[model samples]
Target: MTLPSGKWRLGFDIGGTFTDFVLHEGTTGALTLHKRLTTPQDPSEAALAGLDEILAMQGIGPGDLSEIIHGTTLVTNAVIERTGARTGLIATEGFGDILEMGTEQRYDIYDLFLPFPEPLVPRDLRLEVPERIDASGRVLAGLDEAALERAGAELVGAGCEAVAIAFLHSYANPAHERRAAAILRSAFPDLAVSVSSDVVAGIGEYRRTATAAANAYVQPLMHRYLGRIETALAARGFAGALRLMHSAGGLIPLETARDFPVRLLESGPAGGALATGLFGRAAGLSDMISFDMGGTTAKAALIEDGQAAIAPEIEAARVRRFTRGSGLPIRTPVIEMIEIGAGGGSIAAIDEVGLLKVGPRSAGSDPGPACYGLGGTEPTVTDAALVLGYYDPGFFLGGRMALDAGAARRAVARVADPLGLSVEEAALGIHKVVVENMAAAARVHIVERGRDPRDFAMVGFGGAGPAHAVAVARALGI
Candidate 1:
């Protein structure tokens, strides 16, 4: 199969639940969409398979493909699931506990049960060398080579596959961190090393150190995944250049992504925002809100003047819901979006206090919603939507997965009967509650930035976004 030389665009998005593929003919801008189940074990398998199916259906070959814009959740999954390599941290002596100390702000001030996120590198894996760099970028004490060697030996003994070197004020000077990294690399040639100065050249020691450590934790996984994909693509008789979509809503070369995989942490969400921004432009709307409701989470982003808001830093794997400084901070460029565990597969249940609580937990795609007939016994938001007649069971996923209304009603009854409400009322209540939750999240994220939701038009996408858009908009009094 020869590659096409002109006028064709291929776009693929590997979402949490499904992988969506689009092939557009440049001349007419006609597009075709295909949906496939995402293979979490190896996402590229699904991508390659989907691409083959799309190409065959179009009777086109790889050579006919002009450009392929792709996004994936590989990096995000690595952080959330803690499936990355065993990582060690090297920091200035006496400050090795910065990650544990965090901002010293309690996410749940009144709750004694409030849990803090575990550090990416455990205490034993964390090695502190004798070094001091002040806030003014002055090296108050030089790094001790013997101390670094001892730390390196300990880390190697602790089975660390990667090491993060983050010294106090390294973002400003970086000399100590750089020297420490070189010494570690010299001792452990195969160990992946990430320096805070190279990862995040921003202020805030805790944030910088946490971001660098997170990057180190996920670097080996990302490197292997990307390397495999690149090799597979090259062997497929396609010689075109490959580019990865960044969390900042722009495409960066493969080399850049390889060096800084953290930048792709929110790449999937960024694509949705990009798609929404394009839609807003076509509709001639300037101030817009992009709402994306997928299987695991619902995300909202504010777009003003045709541009999505960008944040210099974002928190990942937070221990508490809607709480700042409760997660590992990642200092990478990303589209500013608020995400909540309020999506199609978010479990709905009654709390011990007799109050209804929606999720910060989800059924995800594996078991999915009970209505999906995929072995999920718990009632989810999608099941609630099904019981409310908001979703057509026959037409879900554009008819890829059939929904079972009977199962949905049964699941809703379990939660609603205990709440002293009828099934229909319970389903509608669940829907309303989730909508308000999403709206409230958007409100907080927007108001914090001194913006109002009323001023922004909503551009909703994802499997559940379009279904819940009007209700959320009404809740916001839009």
Candidate 2:
């Protein structure tokens, strides 16, 4: 495939721990790939750095690229970390409480103390306006313009950087929400605004409102982030279409992604699904499973009939982590998958009852694993793997960075001392727990969809997936 180069298509993916790059020659079938540690300080920097390095390797420049496709965990991380802009909500007078009371369906009937996820807009910031619309798209009462202005001004005065407008029956009749958004924009042209009907107009009030609120919360930030990337890429002589991969299994231009950032929530995981489906078909497989374990989390998806399964909706930032109805609901088409807080950087520690537990918390790329020697003290999956002699300290990452075996042993020993076991024993326990967690989650996801795991070929990718694939496959009886 080493022929004269044609036009180039460059792709970059920003995961929790690494930014991966792939450079493809249009007609020559040549490709160059690279992976660099992620810079959480500003993920764009990592993208640029990786791009430059890949260009140098390919003997090309930014101007030689015909297009750029980028995807990242930024929007999802904002929702999970609650790091987006301060946002307010505007609702119909009698229906403002919908922000708290959902469809009145219990996600878990046996758990009495199940907690609801916090609304993006707090109670004090949720203002109500007098308006009514029937389910049949007829306006029962005209919008209260004075009330709308008052709510907008109150939100502005409350220091809200963004606002969500969700009126009763807006999916059927968006007049009220549209007017409300217009009024707010006229009052404060700079405040980021989102209307429920504009985001999801199909059905389900709670899911629609929650999705719009989530979008508004991240709208300004996403807009600015994309703008920054555009400017930076332009400075590097990149003058091609800049597209972002969305959760629904395809790519959308930057503007579309900015308008509906909530749609980007599963973009990273969706890539894994798309790739698995392609690989399965290329390998003459009819059914398969994709396992992607990144730096912070692991995701699993089922594939059949040469397509990845898709779900109608998803929950974001669940308080209890994996329980349904415990987080903000978003009713968007998604390649159905299950995600768990277990990965290479997943922390291993003793629970309250002194039981060894793998993560719901990750060390991420910052102070990554203790083996990175970046000041991380917690015992993570990477440290456990090192202690188990799975890696050669001198050759990790092609020796781009050295691994610290002493630090890995010390970190695993920290967990070992509490469990009254040797470091090697504790490391084995941690490894088993990590693999079990992933297998258990994947099994539930497959079983719920009425499938047999043993019938599907497992396709594993990502930083840690291949390393632990055999253990996970055996645990799942595949």
| Candidate 1 per-residue lDDT over residues 295-328, each given as its tens digit | 7788888888998888998889887767886778
Candidate 2 local lDDT, 167-203, one digit each (tens): 8898998988888888889989999999999999977
Each model's C-alpha lDDT? Answer: 0.84, 0.87
Report the C-alpha displacement of residue 187, candidate 2, in angstroms.
Answer: 2.2
TM-scores vs. true structure, each candidate: 0.93, 0.97
Off by over 4 Å in 1: 1-6, 107-114, 136-138
- Give the TM-score comparing model 2 with the true structure, all chains together: 0.97
Q: In model 2, state the lDDT of residue 41.
A: 80
